[model samples]
Target: AMFESNMLETKQREIVINDIDPDALEKLILYAYEGRLEIHQDNVTNVLRAAHLFNISEIVDSCCKYIEKQ
Candidate 1:
């Protein structure tokens, strides 16, 4: 595995932020950073999409559990 010093790498972390609005993306980043999230019911789908995209497995599962419990 060769990680060059300067070249851009496609093997970087899989975070698909392009599908989200900028403000919501910022919020998601903050949640991942701080472990505290303030999400609305309307935005659950967006959050689930982000969690799935970023390979945050636990978050995706938790969202599923929460939805099932609702």
Candidate 2:
């Protein structure tokens, strides 16, 4: 949604996400392109939150499944 908004037409064309952890954001980016992600005990919560914030249902479901299995 950020990219779809007018922000992309701005001079910088950059979307700064300050609420999410940098590591989680990195993992989310990796998942977006790779279609795969590793959700470990330490990062599952962070990943889930980021995925939900971005409305990435696949990752959110995966994270929930991982949590249920734990």
Candidate 3:
């Protein structure tokens, strides 16, 4: 679940991402800024994992759709 708006006030200003693959993280960040995903056969699984962890619904949905097409 996502954090509440007030959670940021009492918490540290930084976020740490661990466990996720670097390539996946890089692609997810690009997706966050561009509002589009480059989901492909090779990267789809890692991308989906990153999207799920980061709560990027749009990317998750896009990755799901891409998987469905396979």
Instruction: Identify the runs in model 1 with alpha carbons over 4 angstroms from their true place.
Output: 1-16
Which candidate, 1 or 3, has the higher lDDT? 3
Off by over 4 Å in 2: none
Root-mean-square deviation of Cα positions for candidate 2 versus the true structure, in angstroms: 2.0
The candidate maximizing lDDT is 2
lDDT score, residue 46, model 3?
94
lDDT by residue (1-70, candidate 2, tens digit) is 5446676545465657778988888898998789669789999999999999989999999999999999
Question: Residue-wise lDDT of candidate 3 within 1-70, one digit each (tens)?
Answer: 2355666544767666688888888898787787667779999999999989878888889999999999
Report, for all candidates in order, the number of backbone clashes: 0, 0, 0
TM-score of each candidate? 0.60, 0.82, 0.72
Residue pairs clashing, model 3: none
Full ranking by lDDT: 2, 3, 1
Tens digit per residue, CA lDDT, model 1, 1-70:
2345543454676534467666556657877899866566666667777777767776677667767767
Displacement of residue 2 (Cα, Å) in model 3 is 11
